[model samples]
Target: MENPTFSIQDIPPTLLCYAVAELDFSTLSPNLTNSTLQSLKSCGANQLAGLLSSFTTITSETLVSLGSLAVGLSPSVLENINGSILKENLQSLSTINNWSATQASIIVSKCKVQSDKQINADTLKQLGSLVIGVQSAEIKTLKSDDILSLANNSILTGYMEKAPIVLKKQFVQGIIQATSKTKKTIFQVVPAELASEIPVSNLLDSNLNVSEINQMKWTSSQVLPITNQAQCKSYFTRVGQANIDLLPQGSPKRNTLLSNAKSCLNINSNIITKDNLVILGSLVCDLTDKEIISSDSYVLDALKICSSFTDSQKVAIVTKLKAQYGAPSKWTLSNMKQIGSLSSALDSEIMKTINKSVMIKFFPGLLSVLRVQHKTTFTSVITQLKNSSRIAARDSLTCEEKLTTDSITKQMDLIVARYSAAQLNICTSNETLLNNLNILGSLAFDDDQLKVFKGILDMRLPGGVPNEYLIQLGNIARVYSEKEIRSWNITSVDTLATLIQSASWQSNDSKINEMVYRYLQLNSPNATFDGTLLTVLAPYICSLNQTLIQNITSGALRNSSQSLEVSTCNQNIKNILFDKMKLGYSSVNSTSNAYFQIMSPVIGGARFSDLINFGKGFPEMDLSTFTTLNPNEVKTLSVENIKDLLGSNVLDINTISSSSVLQVWVASKTQMEVNSLGVNATAGIKSPVPNGVTSGVGVPHCTLYLLLVCIMASLLYMDNDFL
Candidate 1:
């Protein structure tokens, strides 16, 4: 029941062939002895064919070798051969010299051929004997060589001549290598449905007549992948301008042909004229920016000569030019002139490509030209110039040239006062102050600007301080108190000196005096008296009290002898006190009650010795130097001074109420008592009379309490006339 096994090498060729043909091939080993394979030639062709048919998995090479051997057997073997084996060995079909036309027809009908592989020429010649044997579709599937071979064979030509349109297109594509005469014949036979589908490159190989080239209408889908520059040149030459123009837009062939056209033709050639280029304009548009820019000079010249462009086409050209050159700095003068010549619209658009510096430098001249040439749009041009100029100015300021005096002034001139404090702060600088002097005079500064201005002033300039700059600093000082100024590092001494030197202190006395006070306060820790400075500051010393004066002079003179130039210092001191006393008394009528109230405590503390010392410095006056002995001065207490003392105490009501001085005054008031005994001038006396006491007795004593109250009240009112 089991199949018998034999060593494949031991089997005889005739016996193996017989067994292979009779048994299920699935049961047989594919391995065969070389002797057995060589002896296959002795087997009958019918048996060999049957053996090939029995094996489903035989290699095509094995089938082919066996089929070749089968040729030595019966011719009838070819007729009964498996179609798969026949198709695999179709190339071998031509080698079968004894094959009949009927056998050829049978093989062609039975086999399923590969579509991609070219059929042998000998096979086509053999198949041509009976064209009806081949499927119409199969005929079209033939490669170029097979189709050309069939084209030459008169027998098969009849069937191919009237093939269906799809088959006709394939047939036309296949015979690309056919002889000119044969290709011409084939072209002449091409059906109308295939007219557009045929590659124009194919027709050129056949020396297609000019009329034929013109007549061929390429569809939009036509693809000609040829890269032969000469062939492309020749095709375009034969087709002429009109027919070449008819090529599909953006088609590969159109690009290939035009690129070749430029290289082939000279600029002066008739084919390269403006009219021809105008016809080929669409092809120019299809070229990439790189391609057009890199194209041959003749091509570019041809484009230049062609002037029949629409506005949109010019725009497209300019757009491409922009892409090619990128920024305007990449363009040369010649490039600018050439691009400018394209159209006024493009010339105007090119302005966008220029660097801001270039525009600002050259715009005025260009604007003049534009005003004449593009008069209607001059205003818009001006507006654009202004906008670009503003950016250029800002960027220039941000560069190394930013803080130059001229640059700062130039930028300031353009500002419309609309910028925020931070934006305006960009312009605050020592250079700005030194150059513009009054830039910050009216400008409102926020906290940050104030800080920046302070820094700007703190920097030492070329000169000590500009004469006119003091006015500007006065505005700043008015806003910044001494504390704020110190925080910003703007030394109050320098500011005060600058203000004094410029005479700005005359109009801004209160601010200047405050600066002096602040400067004095700042130096208090290490203060020393400077006799020379004190002499110059004498008249202006009215604002400061003796205590502050003493502190400042003490510090200024700390290193110097206290007796240095006593004579001159004495005169200066005398003048200072006179000025103080004179101004204080003269200004009291107009001075605020609050001013007097503020000074009231200082006046109340003065003593007779102090009055003598002050009065000695102002001996020219009629003022009296009074102490506890001057009952006359006590009688001179004015209602105004007493009221101001009360008001001054009222402002600090809590401290005054709890003060020891008020306790003493109140205690003295409660202790005072008075007793009186009186007799009429008629000399009547009481019933009980004292010995030395007459009819009437009255008591009034110079008590310490009374004297104390009187002295305290007068002290509160000071030598009230002596401010």
Candidate 2:
């Protein structure tokens, strides 16, 4: 399937024609060789035309040679030649001057000028001579003058008789300078059978004035015919809004125009008007509830005066006004005052649309309205506000409504006076109960309300109690007795801790704390104090039994005590351990069994020996569990404290010697003390190595002498002189 290749120098004339025929002219080289010229010069007019198909540029030399070969133009060759090349070389082609109308039409039709450049006068005249079968598309590029010139030869008249309606419109409209007399002649020449097929748009005829257009015989039958609805819409759009009123009322154009104006309601308010709305209401007998509500305010105002709208239409309009201007959550005291100006039925209908949740939220403002207006029916409205879906009356409280807390309490008091404990309990959600527990207790609930509250707590516990609910529940613990607190099986240690914290918010802090402490001891006797619980109990330790505080705090650290040891805790309790428990060491004495209480603060943070002093014991512990002490603590120890502990034999030497960290401490303490005493360690003092200790990890020799001399001297001078 490969095409045969031929070079320009060796290609024979017949073979060149074959190659030219096989290839697209656009793909061929523009360059020409002497052999190509000779080959083309000897070829017939048909072959010369075929070679020209492949040449991108036609030199005068090439054109002159090709023109000499034109004994006659083959119709087939002219058909294959490009139209642009033919037009450019038309003057040289003398045979076309003698051609018949059919031959000239064939040649001109093949000339391919792809641009929008119009044909000049010469081409028009040449084509005009052969106008018998001329096409509209072929001559579409002719100028207005050239087209008018065709009329002079009667060629345009002939073409219009056969051309389609679209071409006829384009051709006639393109001649902006053509006279009405010429247009009338063109129209007169159009086939009578196709006269009615011309649209009204074509007759808006720049050729005629307004008066002439009106006087035309076909103005109604041809231009404004009452046909289908679509054509009527088009006819009306052409007539425009200013002239639409001139049309007959019963006509299809008028009816369609009115229907479209009525149905097209814009969301924008600025574009709509009262007059337009009146016209719209005339066409649409009934508007939907949403449509009436969503329309502009001007439309609503117009509907009110129109008297054609029904009562439902008025209700829908008021509903939208309430939703926008008086929405329950967003409405303020000012809007509540405006309600007094409204009619009784409209005011009641507006209030009825508000659901229970929203009614509760806006209750304070509405209550203020009722009080100011002296409306006794407000009581019934309040009753209607209490629906099953509303969680609690307090939840509807909008604090931003500028109502005082006292005002809220007064309103709540009036509402709760009529309801029994059972009715209030049914509507209250647990969250509402917890959030307003303090207010609930202050409400002075009768015996039945107290019983209902106890039942709710029981119900809340059977499912696992969320921490927030437990904290709030503990706030109202003063309402119940010790027996009741003990009856509730308080499980999670964390919840027990939260109960102790919540007592501070109640009426009697000490009484509630004691009750909760006793309840914790009785129900969950095995509960241990982690950091959180230990912190909650620390402040009350001075008031409660000392043994209980001791059991909670020291029991975790003492090996003999069986309480659980707390190693990790939240940051709040950890901070409390360091700041509060550490400061509590002022109460420590040799007689107490609270040894771990003294050490608990140091174990939580910082070094053990950093907080350590002379009196506190160097408590024995497993060496493997004690690795977190800071290495720098060894250098900061006082010489007097080191000797006091060493002479007292309080720490086991064997256990200290076994630890690498402790060995460093012992060597560092001895070396530092010797330097502080003003002794030269190279000659005066000897290093001591304990049994079971490594020798190589001793203190460095380069440690400066006279360390802490000023500190030691100041302390000794004060003790001797003042004490």
Best TM-score goes to which candidate? 2
lDDT of each: 0.42, 0.44
| Per-prediction backbone clash count | 7, 3
lDDT string, candidate 1, 527-635, tens digits:
3234323433434444444455544433222111111211122333433433343343342322322222222222323333433433322211111111111222222
Return the clash pairs for model 1, or none: 527-555, 528-555, 528-556, 528-557, 529-555, 529-556, 529-557
Candidate 2 least-lDDT 10 residues: 555-564
State every prediction's TM-score relative to the real structure.
0.19, 0.20
Q: Tell me model 1's lDDT, rounded to 2 decimals.
A: 0.42
Q: CA lDDT of 449 in candidate 1?
A: 44
Q: Which residue runs does candidate 1 get wrong by more than 4 Å? A: 1-421, 427-432, 439-448, 457-472, 475-548, 551-605, 608-723
Give the winner by lDDT: 2
